[model samples]
Target: MAKVSISLDAELVVEVMVLAGIGSPQDAIEAVVRDYVVRGHRTEARTELKDRNLREVDAKPQEPQG
Candidate 1:
């Protein structure tokens, strides 16, 4: 993995460390970012499937079963 150096507020980093229960600021930030990305991917997957299913069902003609 490539490492990049960026500046962030000390107070914000401390908050993230506390919330994530991670002693290292870098680890805490990385964990939080990874979690956010995972959640976004999961949400996109679920919604994309749901939308496609709805459109497919609506486009098809349903016959009444006797």
Candidate 2:
């Protein structure tokens, strides 16, 4: 992927790094952004499937095997 640089507050970056448990600032920001994108995709998929006629499965527990 292409790379670019931007300035951010040191305090904010530190906060994100700690919250994400990543020692590197770049990796921490990248991880958070990637997760946000994934969540957006998931939300879009759920909304699109909301009106679809999908089959539901009911799972039942089986007796324990000896």
Q: How many clashes in each structure?
A: 0, 0
Model 1 C-alpha lDDT versus the unseen true structure: 0.98
Cα error of candidate 2 at position 59, Å: 30
Model 2: lowest-lDDT 10 consecutive positions? 51-60
Per-residue lDDT over 1-66 for candidate 1, one digit per residue giving the tens place of the 0 to 100 score: 889999999999999999999999999999999999999999999999999999999999999889
For all candidates in order, the CA lDDT equals 0.98, 0.87
Error of 1 at 63 (Å): 8.4
| Candidate 2 Cα outliers beyond 4 Å, as residue runs | 53-66
What tens digits encode model 2's per-residue C-alpha lDDT throughout 1-66? 899899999999999999999999999999999999999999989977764534322244557899
TM-score on alpha carbons, each prediction: 0.85, 0.75
